[model samples]
Target: MAVEVVSGIVLGSREYGERGMVVQLYTRELGRVGVMSYAGRGNDGAKLSPFLRVLSTVRVALRLGRHAEGMPKLVDVEEWERGAQRGWSCEKMVVGCFIGELIQRLLEERVPNEDFYLFLLERLGLFAAETQDEVVFLMVFLLDLAKSLGYAPQGEYTVSNRYFDVAHGAFCGRGEGEGADVIAGADAAVWGRLLDGHYLADLHDVDGSQRCRVLYQELRYLEVHSGLRLSLRSLEVLKELVG
Candidate 1:
């Protein structure tokens, strides 16, 4: 009907035409939105990169009578955050891309998930801001993401039973639960901290490889529990690079 203008963050974009690029964005008001911009190339191409984190003041032309599906036109894109010019290690960049893809796949557009939206923004900003010690950040981000996705494993850690079955996301001591692997206290402590929201802010003193292991475990747990089929190529590359 009428054109509506809104502010949105550029989640990802790719070439769609000789000059136009299709952009996916997360808006505070509209959730995930797709915009096709013809003027998004060249010197401004930096604005279309994945996780460019730009804000667009867009003029949207909506199609009527398409309650569930229809393409909307986006006009007047503007750079909001200016995520360019910052140097990120390859691993950091990969992680950022992974986060964007994860959101794009798991989250439905037009539905409000404010908590998840805020969490993603914060975590992305954390990745961008932290120049050192990203392993901890990755671990913490995954754990928090699991919780948000409702796939967080359940457990309580005690001195008597400290090992966690990576698949179960729970503690299994000697002779306990069938098919449960022994859980280590260190892993349990890390998980326990996750329950407290401490893990989201930082991973403390853990090393890079160790962080990768934890991420693998958490992702495996999510795969088994949530059944969300996600490719780990980027994560695997990051792990090998850091290790």
Candidate 2:
């Protein structure tokens, strides 16, 4: 059997049957991979399933097949950096879930993007370590995630050309069209600040409501540009937590 060890983040985990566990993990080596992650069958399956929680950062050894016949099998887990550990508060878990869902939705399987994986791992580790009472962490994470995904917004935001076109992914003098593509006036200005290389660590003073609005707009921008209609269920919960 071909075997390899990799650092991975668990995007999602679910039970299959009486004693089956499956996980979707994004790794630096292989990108998004679905694996039947059972260290043992029957009652002994409890040994490893407890550690493979969603949003956990883990080092896993996978048993690979000679031919690409089916999904790989997780044979051993060396380390588990769980996001929802014993001391983790509800807010931390919520942020982890929201970001996990967004990444899982935005990323496609088998697309090997090393930069994206590293970006996610670094920010995931950071977010896991700190729990804040604001939405800045989420927004900061979005900025990196957007850049990693190759759509960190384009053009500059100015008074004469202030409208943000989500579909075009650039600011314009006036929006090219109506619908989700157009964001104008104060809202557009807020987006420009939030996304226009003006990260929180730089210069930003957005309040709770403005932050939440920018979050919504960021999601919309991603949806329009990613070629997928994103419906992040955790978004509303994240918004409520921040708003």
Pairs in clash, predicted candidate 2: none
Please list the residue runs of candidate 1 whose C-alpha ends up more than 4 Å from where it truly belongs after superposition. Answer: 1-85, 108-112, 165-168, 180-182, 193-196, 199-205
- Over the stretch 1-243, how does candidate 1's per-residue lDDT look in tens digits? 222222234343454322211223334344433443323434322333343443322232222222234522222222233244244444454455455544444542223255655666565555556445555566667767778766666676667666676666676675564553444657666666655654344564666666666667676666676665554443544455445
Q: Which residue segments of model 2 deviate by more than 4 Å?
A: 1-89, 108-110, 131-134, 175-177, 196-205, 228-232
lDDT of 2 by residue, 1-243 (tens): 211122234333354322222222334454433333432233322233433433353332223222254433323222233323546554554555455546555544224255665566666556656544426677766756666778877777797877888777778886364675588877777766656432334424566787788778777776666753444334545655666
Candidate 2's clash total is 0
| Deviation (Å) of 100 in candidate 1 | 2.4
**Candidate with the greatest lDDT versus the true structure:** 2
As a whole number from 0 to 100, the lDDT of residue 174 in candidate 1 is 53
Predict model 2's lDDT versus the native.
0.53
Evaluate residue 85 in candidate 2 and report its C-alpha lDDT on the 0 to 100 scale.
51
